[model samples]
Target chain A: MPHDHDHPHSLLPPDPALRVKALETILTEKGLVDPAALDEIIDTYQNRIGPRNGARVVARMWCDPGFREEMLKDPMPRLREMGLYGRQGEHMVFVENTRDVHNVVVCTLCSCYPWPLLGIPPGWYKSDAYRARVVREPRKVLAEFGVDLPGETRVRVWDSTAEIRYLVVPQRPEGTDGMDEPDLAALVTRDSMVGTGLVPGPTP
Target chain B: MSRVHDMGGRFGDGTVAPGEDAVFAAPWHGRALALTLAAGALGHWTIDASRHARESLSPRDYARFSYYEKWLAALADMLVARGIVTEDELQAGHAAEQSSLSERALMAGSVAGVLKSGSVYDRAGPAPALVVGARVRTRRPARNTMVEGGHTRLPGYAAGATGTVVRLHGTHVFPDSNAHGLGEAPEPLYAVAFEARELWGAAAEGDEVIVDLWQSYLEPA
Candidate 1:
């Protein structure tokens, strides 16, 4: 490994190849990982099946009331029922969004979210600011995300600890009242079901 | 070492930076890439390794692993864009670890030992404090910002906020690192209800907003 201490003068630094190589060497020496094996694992997970599976399951739950109820009571049964059980969502709760009230879920401890339903939680949910602020000042926190609810709507913040994982079942919006299940399904955004946003119907 | 997952709720309220959630808006592949890099950096390779491997870890360990998995997945995208590491390299490393990484990976990932001796809430039994409808006041710390420090009972959003204990949900193991390991004894935790005005300003108007706060975060009004 050649050291780069002897050179410099130009404003632009060289590429980070050396640093990457060094890191790779260190990881290999420590026996922390095998580079070849790692590549295959990453390729399969990243390119193959992804959050789409979880998103579809959530979409299905949004349209099926009975399934949604089962998901709320014990998410695992319904999740397994739907073959969507795994990852961080072994235990789950589906919070229903209703008129006059909205449910926003946060893992105040460390982002214990329902990955099986909504997929991985957004980074903001795990940050110190979100975990801390959302539980206390939810309206304000929601406001920052462009999710401003009138003060009249009560914000119920669920702190997901270890035993339970939660998902927000957003209220079905008005314009989609007469729409069929599949059309209504398109209206369910992961955020809305997470209680951070509403499922707005298709543009008039 | 204190696993970040084991130290939940340690930071006092208000420390979470604004607009942090959108960072996870990337596509699933990007998120997976982020997770792999994080697992490598933290020396915890089993989180997303596979279903069987994950099941082998204890509940506490599983909790920490899950936390890291979410963190890494989100972080990988940022790392790739910043050129800290390449997508190919990150992926390759993850795959290598999958087949050959040993039990050390599991031990290296353990944060169970770092958990505090007693949890603020009892994960094992029942919460030991004010029940729903019990009158309680927010515990006013000497400094409001202290609430912003690492895991505390008080929620940053609820500091200076007051309410009646609305529900006495059964004892939940308090997530605070300082409180995680408390043995068998029950600790008081409460689900308090606060008026929207109390959390926001007077201009706010809504039915009372209910939050599940621990007993440590409250005081007698």
Candidate 2:
């Protein structure tokens, strides 16, 4: 038999809209989802929301050391208490930074991230190079991202394989002693939480 | 087929820092191809079953069942065109390798191990090195600053950042040509803690940060 070896263009296509539409049709016919509710769900998630909701909780934890400790030991209860627990993040571990070391996270297999607190990860993080090289040569990788540490400092890398996801509780920078919770929340950057870039200096 | 994960120690660089333009380029056709392949396979099986019914069953029964057969005929046509499985052997070899559960499990386990090593594909055990909390410094690579060819797990971001031993995971494994398969050594993995100040200078917050690192990625702090 002569195979029609057209090869069908490519195995992976760039256009996801057609797939999404087909899936929607299949799901509708199967009574999985009502066609009317799909648009509402996508709109609410894509536009209005932000990571600020999770950041507020972390900010509050930062202000209260006892609460911070409790949150770190068991984040689920705390997240439920704050009513910020939902979607992809069911558990969390807040890794604190001190005078001696730094923390960075990578999902060696896939982009497993703490979406509850940080929302979606940046494009650079999901790249193959970042995933492959970060665990292999963290120091050099961090330097390329403009986070240079001294030769004497020790770099520790975390490869997230299990369900336990991580968030870096960056040591609160100096000169923000009196800042309130909301203002402090503004200081927290997604990169700091991931241990890539630090929290930028307080605005001006 | 080579497992997707095993990549390491094979001596060449695979790191290609694709620019932004290339990253955003259209590449979703790959997904379509997968869907098409699946659709074609299903079509082939359906046609074979229908042909069997025609040869064995009475004309009346075949007519009764023919209405129920919708995409199977189209699927078969597509499959025949693509040469996935011939009309004669619709489902012959499908269960050949998968029939034995134990054999399948063993093959899967070995493949998983090989994929994890990020090196040449082999079914060795783990890597041997320092303990998780044992203070170990990273050995500077002798050549190729851009490439990592040493016994270290120090990530690019946490390089030079130090911390204490936290957890010991397991031994590291990589493919070994010397063993003609996968190789392993008794090495400990650790979750090292670093202070945010050390990583981000003045911009850091709180007191410390902890990272689960491997034995190969640390040096005595």
- Per residue, candidate 1 scores C-alpha lDDT tens digits across B34-138 of 334434444332222222122223344334433334333333333333344345445344222322443343232232221111112235664365656677777
Candidate 1 lDDT score relative to the true structure: 0.50
**Tens-digit lDDT string for candidate 2 (A1-204):** 322233211121123544334433332332323433443333223333345665676678779989888877777777766755544355466667665767777765345576557654555565556666665566666776778766555555666633356777776778888889999888886677777766665776
lDDT, candidates in the order shown: 0.50, 0.46
In candidate 1, position B16 carries an lDDT of 41
lDDT of 2 by residue, B101-201 (tens): 12211121232222222121112345435554566444333111322231222334455565666654444331111111122433344556555466455
- Top candidate by DockQ: 1
Question: What number of clashing residue pairs does each candidate have, in the order they appear?
Answer: 44, 84
Q: Which stretches of candidate 2 lie over 4 Å from their true place?
A: A1-14, A48-50, B5-221
The alpha-carbon deviation from the true structure for residue B9 of candidate 1, after best TM-score superposition, in angstroms, is: 15
Task: State every prediction's TM-score relative to the real structure.
Answer: 0.57, 0.51
Off by over 4 Å in 1: A1-25, A34-64, A106-112, A123-152, A159-164, A175-182, B1-101, B106-123, B127-130, B138-150, B157-161, B165-169, B177-191, B200-203, B207-211, B215-221
Cα lDDT tens digits, model 1, A1-204, are: 222221110111122233233334434544544555444443433443334554565566667778776766666665666666554555555667777778887765445566545554566666656765565566766777677786567777766533455667777677665676666667777667666667776789
**TM-score of model 2 (CA atoms):** 0.51
